[model samples]
Target chain A: MKRGFNFSPGPGTLPLEVLEQAAEEMLDWCGTGMGVMEMSHRGKAFMSILNQAQDDLRELLMVPDNYKILFMQGGAVAENAIIPMNLLGYCAETPPIADYIVTGFWSDKSQKEARRYCNVNIAASSEGRHFTHLPRQEEWKLSQDPAYIHICTNETIHGVEYFWEPDLPGVGLPEVPLVADVSSHILSRPMDVSKFGVMYGGAQKNIGPSGMTFVIVREDLLDRALPICPSVFTWKTVAENNSMYNTPPTYAIYIAGLVFEWLKRNGGLKAMEKQNVAKAQLLYGYLDSSNFYCTFVEKDCRSRMNVPFFLHDDALNDKFFAGAESYGLLQLNGHSSVGGVRASIYNAMPLAGVQALVDYLRDFERIHG
Target chain B: MKRGFNFSPGPGTLPLEVLEQAAEEMLDWCGTGMGVMEMSHRGKAFMSILNQAQDDLRELLMVPDNYKILFMQGGAVAENAIIPMNLLGYCAETPPIADYIVTGFWSDKSQKEARRYCNVNIAASSEGRHFTHLPRQEEWKLSQDPAYIHICTNETIHGVEYFWEPDLPGVGLPEVPLVADVSSHILSRPMDVSKFGVMYGGAQKNIGPSGMTFVIVREDLLDRALPICPSVFTWKTVAENNSMYNTPPTYAIYIAGLVFEWLKRNGGLKAMEKQNVAKAQLLYGYLDSSNFYCTFVEKDCRSRMNVPFFLHDDALNDKFFAGAESYGLLQLNGHSSVGGVRASIYNAMPLAGVQALVDYLRDFERIHG
Candidate 1:
């Protein structure tokens, strides 16, 4: 806590409690006399840790029995290819088709990776608008009998969020399954478990750490994977083995379990959502009310987790960053592609941290606005 | 360290010092105000860490100017496919035949994966002797003009080691490049960097934790990858970007850097190898002098890192394990295939720990012999 509240998008801050507990348990876990890292993934002590972690994660997410939760590596970027390779089996040969709604950087990457696996229909894209907003659901031109419809519910870099889950049934796309990349905003609010066919994210942002990703997939989608899919990335194989098909990232899983436990103890997703709303509102309210700062996303689509705003005077960007650093709200600088300030308020970021940033914003506005 | 001495092959024991330093640095690194995990991979602070880690690893291994180092995931398992996809470009459109010298489980897996890429030739096998030995180089029936000769320098499961580096120049065959999976015994000793075209392994064993694999390849091998190889896994692309083609497993890299620095502090690989030899000799010596237990590997090929042995009576297997557990010895259970015991004296497992296990063996023999 010596530094200010860090707000790097992914590979972001973890709860201090999780880090403390992890450090405390490094030499010996539950009196097992071995660090979790040193234990074999198959040994009883580590197996128990692994089992409890999976079980606790299942409980926390309330993952349906039919759906499998895979713990994997190569981050979400890998899943961009892995998902299509695993799910496109539903389509007839020659070349399968999948639908994508490109919100920002992540969905674009996913769509590109999907292209490698099948014919991809970019049913909707806000890219023409420079991804300042997510296109309205009605604007999409989804494919007929597509493999799946992919979306990034939260665009980390663009700071746009889909506040509402697309109602495929209401939209007359009843049979199509929707997949979401919730990397930046997952667990910051409540999500409907039943609405989506799959939800995947790298653990770096809202989850726990790098080297692991959490994928919640419907049970029905488990069986069909392209033969080209690496065995390690197949959802069915990973799910059947309980994420232990290949040696799982043991330490990452353990840390994630601790995080899940922490989330539970601090009042689950509902409680977290309340805090997130408050923090987001405080930052956005400040940004909107100030003429000195401008946020690009439409109000309806602004992300609760990320608020990217640029000062009116671009020349002062460096000064703003340096001033913010001195005050301890680190990583205030925005994405390179979109320069300015971005404060990512993930589950681990306390409300007070956000308030502190808002206070700084106000004080800075008073001086430089 | 409360456990007697964890000798389980991998995700094995790590140094007490490294764990302590890691624990202390878990939340805040170097008083710089943020934990390593919390930093963005591209940030200067994290880049410095990543760079130093790569540089130190390069320095420790004495990697040549031409060779590029890749810190990858999916361990050697994914590497099974990745290796061939990268190297098969040296072959024609039909893909040249590849030679595999099977020694143990890992090499067997590498062979199976290679079949998906090229015409695989089993150059030699010691499996006929139950993997208790390494087949002599002269006995190998290598294919002429094969793309490369693949071998596992350290077979973790069967505990048969290739202690001597093969001088391919004198083999009187086409000077095919050599590829070795040095997963289990890397960093434990000095390796002749110039002798290998490509070497890769999972990090769970001797490196740091699971999920991180280090691949050291000679420069010329970079451009030889088959076109189908994933852009993310292309060694040349990874090398050019300094392994940041993807996130590069930030935390694992951090810990491995700590391990590398620790290795340097403890008198480099030469000193560590001496310690490892003494530790392996101590345990193996006890097993040899006693009638109660027996190691199956040939005298010439026994692994200096992994020593798998069997008790004279199978019935006492349970009793032996239970007794060992009570004495705080952990993960000494043998591989299921072998139905005996394996004590992996990896670099992380200290010399005193090995001595203690040897003492336990002597004490056990007094009662059970």
Candidate 2:
């Protein structure tokens, strides 16, 4: 009854080592008779766990001293509203203008939610191209004095990702801090923490589990939370309390800490990036070569993590999905809006899972084609 | 080394059976190649788990079909604000009157968050009494028509509880739906589901874990979410999606399901109540009879779940806690707001744990009193 590859964009797979370590310590954490889940967030055991996780994630991401990492909840979706509410607080004179670069589903969500809290400017979009490609930096429509330039570095749905970090240094958007919804690709590889003023993602995908989110923001931005922001969600309040302004997702943080340790043990982010590249290449190469399969995203922007593909013959979709499941390759079904197949190769996914999936893909095409 | 009894209000203790089952399922879930932690919420395996958990909880609680059970994140703190946002939609045409009865820290938190969205009336308050009892219903300043009358049925901090369901029939509040934040005492005993129009609890207490929240809302109130409410937190949206609109906390829900089954196997909520009563009685009896220890709450309103007590001689408090820790009774430190000791006896905390505390208390008093 072994489970198949879980291709959920998030609340997705976690490393077996991380889960194993957590299970072993479930009843008694660090000789403290109580598990991490049972401990008070203010207690020494949980404090140690929380601090270590924050520090390790910082070291791994090479976060600059000026940034504050917050462990909050409600995922990227809630942050859509929270980000604007907090970021646009400086719009004291009137509603602040925020610039958005629409890449796919997530950016669309961010843009819509931001509209609730500010006057949003769509500085750029790939919507004209049906979101199958990323618009280059040169194409973005600039807005003056926008509160922030928001982007979804990785769109989990459309499978289009930004492999190169945007350069805002000389661009008109330089003064406006870049805010990225990096939900699907935060820790898949190393990040330039200082490149963006704020980076946030739900933990379900690449971090650890579903109940927590990782937010890294420049320390100076902490004080600007709008008066309307919930105190618990306020960055200044959370930072001042060391991320314990409220009872955080203790177990999730513990598991995420275990993942950070595992990541360190398995070679740092560069090594992870290399492995991710290898995994993505193996799957994409097979799909591109097969006439029976078609990947919608352009070659250059294909995500190194989530890969959504469609069979040339859409009629065999269910049979394709059923066959894949029997082969122990699961959740290949694509998003409802785009009915086909999607394979999310998050960090927890091993190279073997991708090979198995690729192998299954080839075999399925051979028979179904 | 066994852990000490964790007495921190929430992110609290869980049933041993639940933790053990979770531990066993860490590597693989019922032969699925993945652990529950690794499964996508959309994956069939995790969905099956989710469905079963929802079904079992529905059965255990006998929740009406008209009521929707939502599994959400952000704990009770987030729900404090989210609740008013979603519920206020129905009250939008009106002046947005909502009644809140503040008993202790948690209720105070709920009231403060609700004020952000609605015209909250402090229907009753025990804060002036130093949180030693539930505010008498007769003294309540009832509004003729409120969007909802809110109550923190069980205060996690002051250890004061309403021994009986609030009777609002005499007041105009009868037609006004009763909304209760049952965060600390949701399933410790059988609850009259029909009494509350909405009941919500943070999972860290008696349910599963910290990151998850269990919300039960009557169906009619479901569709009234404000247009700006985040879909993930909207009761209507969650019920329609069966708690899977977003990637749910699959592992947490699975663990909660296991706890539900464990409760059923051990005689359901009725049996749980009996055990809790006996356990609380044992500890409170010792405290009542001892010259050196005292309980602040009135006997009629004292909680059978959380017992906050103190040494008559404050100087010996540290020695009392240290000695209790030596006996493996942990988390005895009281909340900082109240400088004393507190003991929480959730469903997962067996009578044995309480007995152990009583034994330790007697020994400590014998030497130090």
Candidate 3:
């Protein structure tokens, strides 16, 4: 059976080549006589896999030598708390204040979870505009001193993204450590890893699978974990132990390694970024031109990864989804929080897949209009 | 190439059939047009897979109706802290005291981790005997009102196991909640789920892979989580959300579901127990009679899952490991903490595998003796 184009927001589409390769190696990995999942995390075979994955990812992203790439668990949601537990020690305040730029659903969740561990200050919010655009950096209410500044670079549900990193000095805030939750669009484009104090995301979207979380933390930021932090989750412990403080999500890491290799083999992130931009333009361009379909997010801030749009007639929503699914487009239905259609054309999603969806969109409009 | 007898302790061997089935469905699952990993966790296809996995696991374990099963991340090492964060609220003392029966390596680790969250009391320890045996229950110094009594039912490293559940009355202890870390031996044999307050394990051993951690806790114990507990790791929150508090290790859960099905098709835990006993007996019986190799654990309390034995001449350790590997045996080397050889014959390991190892053992003894 032919595989469909999967637009799942997360645990989302993976390159067909990677999936085929993984399946081929399911029983035996590199002649190790054991499946990757069956090998001990401490064993030489798995260590090599882990090391190679880290190295390839570091090279692919041009990650700075001083930053440590940690393969973690619990996803970005868990990191909401883990981040404060690790970073709050830098603040001398009684209850360390964490400044957050809440752009959409994910950042909102991050701030709420952070409240459980530290004093959270919303430095800026795009919610007033329904998360359609980024709040200008200059408008943010910078705190006198914050343990760290956090932002979700790309909002998966809202389809809003930051085209450029926030320049703190230009925004009138003192130089501070910046943390970005790049879960949705991590590897889709080249990133300046050196600019951020830390960058992390779930592996499910552009990386590989759901279990492993990627944390790229600057080396100096690793030392200040709160006493309450779980030892395995402590950045200091994990980095010092080389993400082997515990048995990591080995299989997930292995898959992510395959993805990193696939990304490298296919012209790296630069090529991926070009394709992602074209796919986004094809969908957004169609929606912009067609009166029958509409996108809520502003054009300038539209995500290159997730494109959430709606049909003009609410009654056509179900019909639109059904028609798309029939054409081998799957999980195109939007998030329940934002009801419509969401096409997550991530790094693994090819131009042909987007063109297929675009073709279906035109065909559906002709029949229904 | 033929698959060798894999003896790596945790992240160990899996049923070949499960791996084959996973491979067949790698590109597309049940004509869903998307692979299991590519499907959204909230999507109907994945929801069905998740529910089926949970149901199959419930049936296989005969879990009590009052218990809630949580699929979490970070393996057993992470759960060491997560368990206390969720269970230590019952103690009203200045600093809650957790009673730990440290029989071997894992239990010692558990108690040490618990110290970071609460006061830990070593109620019983086999360290006096160099972890060669389980300390008799009668010899334990019970904590009058500890939050919970913790034990590692099967110590994967030291090859010690508790054959019988400790009856508090038999040991002059109170009827406090019992928490057992059954990482290496879970599902290898029949277990009375009603006997313990909680039974948790990392999936890498008998379940599926390294990413997912399973926690089977009685419903009454879910609400005692401390204020500091990360919401994602909290049992109450995880159970309320059906382990979807955060994006669960979806692929790992799917693989675990496949394993549960595999376990059922091969006869439930009862049949598995008989086979496990036979495998353990074959290996142990040989070591008991042989002058070249010896097992340290007391005969009455030996793990049916992990069998750590030693070459009488320590210098031959490398030779024994090399010989075993050459004979289609793999990972015969023991953990670094234990400087010998360990043959982890888990549920997925066939009797033939053990027989092959035994045959190799005999041949090696004849040549080296």
Candidate 4:
């Protein structure tokens, strides 16, 4: 049975092969006579699964030896608060200031959540332009001695993305640690782990499932959490326990392990980035050629993972979605906050799926343009 | 292919039928082209799964109408801090006091975590008795006006359980809310939801997979979170958002929904209780009759979910475990903190598995007695 082209923003499409392997191993993993979900997290079978997953992820991302990979819970929204709780104490300021480069909804949320723990500095923002572009580092008005500067590298809602890594020294800021919520596009391309103090994401988008959050933090950033930070949310505690601070979501970790293995078998992140770029170009090119559809994000900042496009005639939106669904293009509707259509082509989306979507877009245009 | 008789404490065992159905639905659920894990949390297909699961659970537990069921993340250990953060603000005292009945490791952890936010009073304790019995309410030293009273209804590690609900009025205490962590035995029997202000548990035991935490909080207790509480851990925010405060552990919730349906089809909690009582009686009956094996937990307070017993001679412990493994018994070893054998026969473990375990016990005793 063929699977449909799932373009949902998150809890997004997963590789068919990976899902098949998971199903095959559902009853008994590695002939252990017990399902992976049934094994104790501390037992040898699950420990092996956990360790192998951590190692494979580290290898795939080329994570620095100085960083620790933590399998966490509560998604990126939770991290909006956890990030502050863990980092606010590191600053010498009476009430630390954390600079935020607010590109879209998620980064704005991070800034607001941080206000509970510290004073927030909106160093740079594209909110005046309705989040149509990423804020350049040179334009940022960073505060002196801030705890960290945060950015949401990819905005799933508005389809804005940062193509260039921030250069703190180039921008005349004195070595403020960079923290990123790369939730939507963490594994879509290669990233320089050493460039940031922390890189974290929810696993639903480019990774495996929805419940698990992955954190890659520099060792120096550990143990700086405020006293009020929950022990479970404290990165140093989680890192020290090898992500087993408290059960660590064994089943989700197993599925994520499978995904990391799938990525390795398919030539890692460089190959993944190539496919993502091609997918984005194919969809954006069609939107560009047709006067019937248009995208609001700036060309230079358009996301390679999520492309939110709108129809020229609002009346045609329903028909477009209906037709797309009939062609097995599922979840094409954009986020409720920004209504139109969005096609999220993550790592698991095949090139053929994007091709089929373009075909549907052309057919719809012919009928309704 | 018969599964082994698994007796792991938590993340312990699952109903075989649920595993089969999950495997079958891994590719497409209910004719939806996307798997449950692949579907967006807000999509119609997943909304149906989420809603049905919530409804079925409500029906199975007979939870009160005033209580809201929240599908949460971060597990029970995380909830130790979350509970205090959410409820501490409700108290009128300058720094609110919270009473704890520390029956075992979990409740003790809860008390210690709460101290970070509120003053914790040990109202009752079984630690002096090595957690062998539940602390009787009659002996509890009630404090003046606490934020809430916390208890671990069932201790997975020490195999201690509360068979009776605490009568707050009977102990001369005001209407202080009762919060219980029923992680290991949530669905083992019927529970009166109105008796407690909150009941929360991790899904690894009795429910479904790991990573998802289920909270049943009285609606009135919703909005008292301390400002320091992360928005994601704020129970009122999560309850108001219908557990979609963040993209919940979708797959775990789906599995839990399936488990709830399975429970309803096979005679709900009342029927589950009967089977559980019989299973516990069978194993404990055998242990009581034999001088070769003895359980340390007091008889009346013994957990129906986890039964930890020691061999008469410590020398035979390794051989006992080895022999049990050969007999298709798995994970019979107790928690590392408690050195012995433990049989965690949750709702998923069948009568025949317990019988097989008894037979193995008799055989081991025959050889080593």
Higher TM-score: candidate 2 or 4?
A: 4
Badly placed stretches (over 4 Å) of model 1 are A170-175, B1-3, B93-96, B172-175
Question: Against the unseen true structure, what C-alpha lDDT does each candidate score?
Answer: 0.85, 0.84, 0.90, 0.91
Question: Which ten residues in a row are the worst by lDDT in model 3 chain B?
Answer: B167-176
State each model's TM-score restricted to chain B. 0.97, 0.96, 0.98, 0.98
TM-score-sorted candidate list, best first:
4, 3, 1, 2
Enumerate residue pairs that collide in model 3.
Answer: none
Please give the fraction of native interface contacts (Cα pairs under 8 Å between A and B) kept by each candidate: 0.59, 0.72, 0.82, 0.75
Candidate 2 residue lDDT tens string, A211-312:
788889998787677776777788888889988888898888999999999999989799899999999999999998999999879999999988999888
Off by over 4 Å in 3: A169-175, B169-175
- Residue B135 accuracy (lDDT) in model 2: 73
DockQ of 3: 0.85
Pairs clashing in candidate 4?
Answer: none
Better of 1 and 3 by TM-score: 3
Clashes of each: 2, 13, 0, 0
Per-residue C-alpha lDDT of model 4 across residues A91-200, encoded as one tens digit per residue: 87887889999989899988998899999999999999999977777788988889999999999998998888887777665556799999999889998888888998
The DockQ leader among the candidates is 3
What candidate 4 gets wrong by more than 4 Å, as runs, is: A172-175
Among incorrect, acceptable, medium and high, the docking class of model 2 is medium
Candidate 1 C-alpha RMSD relative to the actual structure: 1.7
Candidate number with the higher DockQ (2 or 4): 4
